[model samples]
Target: MNAIEIINLTKYYGKNRGIIDVSLQVKEKSIFGFIGPNGSGKSTTIRTILNLIHPSSGEAYIFGKNCEKEYNEILKDVGYLPSEVFYYSNMKVIDLLKYSASFYKKNCDDRINYLSKIMNLDLTKKIEDLSFGNKKKVGIVQALLHSPKLLILDEPTSGLDPLIQQNFFNLLKEENKKGMTIFFSSHVLSEVQKICDEVAIIKEGRIIKIEKINNINNNNYKRIKIEVNYKIDDTFFNNIEVTNLIKEKNIYTFMYKGEINSLITKLSKIDIINIWIDEPSLEEIFMHYYDEKM
Candidate 1:
């Protein structure tokens, strides 16, 4: 069974478009990445799925329950960490966490203490005294305290430092091992590439492509950079399979996805000083999708 299913989900705010006909399914026990640049409706899609914001059209399902109509029941097994963290300034971190835990039926004290130790959060400090990153830690603990079957995170690493970020990723992996489904939404490509089993690329509030990470990494796309003895025409390497082609002085760079022999055959005629070809990074592949004209 799919953990989450969004069917042609679309949302609008007044005249502004939130998402347009976005459809995707996240498999059970998998880490799914929803990637897009800022303001491309990543949050909107997530909000719609959680029924935090009503969709203008279409619907979403969580564990086979209608998200909009049965949100109360669905939320029991769902843990959510929004992009922004907020809390009462005067409340102690521990007190605030206790309050959040009260909403769920099970005891989360042990889970809370364990997560706080891992995240290095100071539960004794007042919420107002904590740094932004520390507050984010509190949010993280809150989200996981219930040991929810599904965890949804939006821009989770925004305020976390590198070491903490890796630790958090490790924690996520551990959770996944226990059969928890994770929905990770972020604009950063490398993190998504590293953590997600499958990723859906969103641009201008629409999903352009969805693929497994292995297929994306193992695909034949190559990052090619050529340095010739002299300047060359910009279109010299133009091909249907080439994207982001650019020429600056004696250097030419682009992403290619086709037969290597065909590319080398054309290069054989040119006076090349050096040529470099390597697998394209996920960021480059993301650019290739964004750089395309819609």
Candidate 2:
């Protein structure tokens, strides 16, 4: 069974729009990335999947059970961390975590302590006394203490330091390896590139693309730089499937997508002093998506 499935899901608030026909499928034990600009319905889709808010049309299912009808039972195996977290200001950090753990049947004290140590959290402090980063750590611990089957994170790295973010990602990889499926929602394309097996890109409250990370990169344009021993005519690279080609004395650089043999054959005619070829970053590919829509 899929970890999460949405069949033409749509939601509306009075006359306001939420999402439209947002169909998606997250396979079990897979780390799926959900990406979009702010207010683009990423959160709305997640909320509907969790059954936090009702959808006006279509339906969502988790582990083959209808989300709207089986949310109570589903919650037992799910952990969620929102873009923003809120808690009783007066409560101590440890107290708040204990209260949250109470909702689950397992005794999570040892798990709580273990997570706190790894996250470098001070559970003795009052909730109001912690910084935003610390509070986010608390949320991270809260979500993982029960070793849930599924983890839903929304902009989960906000306010986290670089070291903490690295540690957090490593921890997530460990959990995912242990059979916990993950749904990561964020605008940070770099992180998604590094972690997700497949990515779903949403724009203007609609899903525009869903594909494997490898598939996206395999067809990605390559950036090439060459320094010939002698200068070449401007039209020498004509019909070579290049973009952004620039020439400076003996150097020529551009983005290439055509056959490598064609490029090598052309370059063999010249005395090349230096050459460089590299894969474009995920950020470049992400920008290509938005640019094409324009």
Candidate 3:
């Protein structure tokens, strides 16, 4: 069964479009990545799914229940962490957690204790006194303490240190192993690449591509920098699909597409001194998509 399903969902604000005809299904027990640039409607879609805002058109469903008609029941099994967290400044961490826990009838102390130890969160400090990163830790604790079946997190790593971020990811992996479904939204491609089983890329309020993480063409291209014994004319590399070419004396740095064997075969005839190949990063792949949209 799908953990969440959105069908032809659309939203608008006055004359501006928020999202249009966006449809997606998140499978059970999978980490799904909702990726887009800022203001691309990722948050809008999430808010609509949570029933925090009414959709202008279309429908959203949680576990086969209509989002609007069964919001209370649906929310009981879900935990959400918004991109921006706002807490009462004067409240202590323990107090805030206790207050949040009051909404559910079951005791949550065990879950809270487990998460606090794993995240290394200090519950003694007041919300106002905690650092930004620590406050994020508190948010993480609250979101996971209930042990909700469906977890929705938006930019969850905003203020976390590198170490804590790694720990949090480890925790997510553990949770997924027990059959939890996670839908996380972020523009950080590297983090998404690390944890998500599947991803959907949105551009200009529309989802342009959806693919399994393992299916991505990570081997798109390579960059080669060669130091040649003889100076070559610029036209020698013109028809070679070369990009970002930099030449200094007899050395040339350029990007190449396709197999290395063909390029190597051609370069073998040249008097070459040394060469190095650079692989493209996830950021470079994201930028390629963004540029296509523009």
Candidate 4:
């Protein structure tokens, strides 16, 4: 079953467009990545699905229930951490956590303590006195304490340090193993590539593409950098399917999308000094989509 399903989901703020005909499905117990540049409708689509904002037209479903009409029941099994987190500044971390727990029927004390230890959050600190990163830690703890079946996170790593981010990712993976579905939205493609099973790329308020991470990695696009004993004419690569060609003294660098054998045959003719070929990263693939006129 799909954990989340959005069908022709369009949202408009008066005359301004929020998202245009966006549709996608996130499989249950999987880590799905919603990625796009800033203002590309990532958050808009997320908010619409959560029923935080009414869609101009479209339907959002969470676990087969209408996200709008059945949100109260659905929310009990959903957890969300917005792009930017805010809380009552006067309360202590533990107090705020307990208050958040009060909304749920289950005791979150053990969950709270476990998450706090993993995130290295100080429960004694006041929300007003904590740094931005610390505040983010508080948000992380609160979101996970309830042990929701579905977790929706937007720009979740904003203020976290590297170590903390690693821990958070690990935590998500652990939860996923236990059947928690995660919807991770962010502009950071590298992290998305690291954890997501599939990704939907949005641009200009539309979903331009959706593909599995493995499919994207094996898409036959290669990033190649070669150094020759002597400077070679740029025309050497003109016959091949290449983009972003760069020449610096005796080295040539570019992206190639074609049969590897053809490239090897061409490379055999060059007096090569060194060569490097690697799969294009998610960020590089993301650029390929955004670079288009659409």
Q: Please give the RMSD to the true structure for each candidate, in Å.
A: 1.7, 2.6, 2.7, 1.4
Question: Global lDDT of each model?
Answer: 0.91, 0.89, 0.87, 0.92
Per-residue lDDT of model 3, residues 49-94, tens digit only? 9999888999999888899889999988899998988899899999
Q: What does candidate 3 score on TM?
A: 0.87
Model 4, stretches more than 4 Å misplaced? none
Q: Write the residue-wise lDDT of candidate 2 on 39-85 in tens digits.
A: 99999999998998899999999888899999999999999998888
**42-158 per-residue lDDT for model 1 (tens digits):** 999999988889999998999999999999999999999989999998999999999999999989999999999989889999999988999899999999999999999999999
Ranking by TM-score: 4, 1, 2, 3
Clashing pairs in 1: none
lDDT of 1: 0.91
TM-scores for candidates 1 onward, in order: 0.94, 0.89, 0.87, 0.96
Which segments of model 1 are wrong by more than 4 Å? 233-235
Candidate of highest TM-score = 4
Model 4 TM-score, all chains together: 0.96
| Residue 57 lDDT, candidate 1, scale 0-100 | 94
The local lDDT score (0 to 100) that residue 49 gets in candidate 2 is: 86
Indicate whether candidate 2 or candidate 3 has the larger TM-score.
Answer: 2
Q: Candidate 4, residues 1-294: lDDT per residue as tens digits?
A: 899999999999999989999999999999999999999999999898888999999899999999999999999999898888899999999999999999999999999999999999999999999999999999989889999999999999999999999999999999999999999999999999999999999988999999999988886578999998787876877888888788888788888888899899988998898999999888987887777544
Which scores greater on lDDT, model 3 or model 4? 4
Off by over 4 Å in 2: 226-254, 266-274
| lDDT at residue 72 of model 4 (Cα atoms) | 93
